[model samples]
Target: MIEIKNLSKAYKKRKVLHHIDATISNPGIYAVLGPNGSGKTTLMKICMGLVLPDEGDVYIYRESVRASIQYRRMVSYLPQIARFPDNLKVKELLQLTEHLRGKAQRKEMLMELLDLDPYMDQLFRNLSGGTQQKVNLVTCLMYDVPLYLLDEPTAALDPVTQIRLKEFIQHERERGKMVVLTTHVPHLVQAIADEIFFLLYGDIYFHGSVEQLIGAYQANDVEEAIARLLMYEQEKVKI
Candidate 1:
């Protein structure tokens, strides 16, 4: 479980995250949904211990992330965008990452599961965007980490590849790994997310099961549900 308590961040005295407190107990896919600049990325970075928060603590499995290298070892993260060495081949990149992670050999299970065989010899810069995403994802999942944090992981994939990734997420969840991701694609969220965090204006406006959102909003789909919530919020501010 991941617990965030009174978390906040500011840049040059301009606040981004407020005193946000959230608990992620459900060990399945949890989608963090938000528009641009809603502080989703900042929250993820803080949870991953990449960014320091001005106030509050992040706890993973009852351990403070900031104080324990062991806690960091149990987490896998795939950023929204990544840049690799332009001169490295796919194999070399994977090799380097695995070595750094202390995994001398690739996890054959993960490689086969993600269908990573096809691009082993391709240059990092030459692969298509979607393929690059696959590589990025593979690099993270290769480690037997308990927590997975992915940001907009399906942004550039085709329908087939997207479907494949959805399956992969489910598989990971079933293995008792906590999968948290941020996404703007409602369809993808509806398909895989057991819980949704609807963030607005740097706050978590709603956090509930996907079915709860659909029922509470009286919407037939996730998109409509999201639209209803946003519209209601807008009207509340107008009054």
Candidate 2:
């Protein structure tokens, strides 16, 4: 479970997020949709305790994330971009991560699922962009955290890999894990999202079930519905 209350963040004097409140509980996939610079990544960072909120609180599993930083151990965060030590080999990286995680079975399972074996001997910097993304995904999934926060997880993934990743997400959700993802692609969101959050100007302008979004926008698909909502927000701003 994750609880965010009156959460806000800023750099210098410019505020990216305002007072916001949201709660996500149990095993379900939550999709967060927002325009560029709407603070979607910022929110995820705060939830993961990587960034402190300028105001308000974040509760993970009923405890303040700030008070129990170890709670982060139970979370797997896939940031917008992942950076790895240029010289480390895939196998070495996984080995180090597993050592740090105290040798968890989940790490091995994720490596197998991502087909990372082929690249085991290759240096991190030598891998292709898509392969690097695959490695990052595998790393995060390895923790077997009950909560996952993924940002633009499919950016460099191929179609088949993307489908496989989605299937894995679904499997985790079925196992009663919480997954929160931020993506520009609405089709993927439609396929896996049970709940959707539409963000504008650092605020959640709308949050509801997927069915409600479809009905409210009267759209044939999730992508169209999100487009309509974005346009509606733009029009409101203009007025």
Q: Which candidate is the best by TM-score?
A: 2
The residue-by-residue lDDT of candidate 2 on 1-239, one tens digit each, is 88888988888887888899999886899998888888989888888778898899899888887677777878888988978787999989878877776665576677777778889999999998999999899878877678899998888988988999999999999998999999998899889999998888878888998788988999988888888988887798899
After TM-score superposition, what is the CA distance of residue 152 in candidate 1 from its true location, in Å? 1.5
After TM-score superposition, the amount by which residue 85's alpha carbon in candidate 1 deviates from its true location, in angstroms, is 1.7
lDDT scores in order? 0.84, 0.87
Off by over 4 Å in 1: 104-106, 109-115
Q: lDDT value for candidate 2?
A: 0.87
Q: Highest lDDT, which number?
A: 2
Error of 2 at 12 (Å): 2.3
Score every model by TM-score: 0.92, 0.95
Worst 10 residues of 2 by lDDT: 101-110
Over 4 Å off, model 2? none
By summed lDDT, which 10 consecutive residues of candidate 1 come out lowest?
104-113
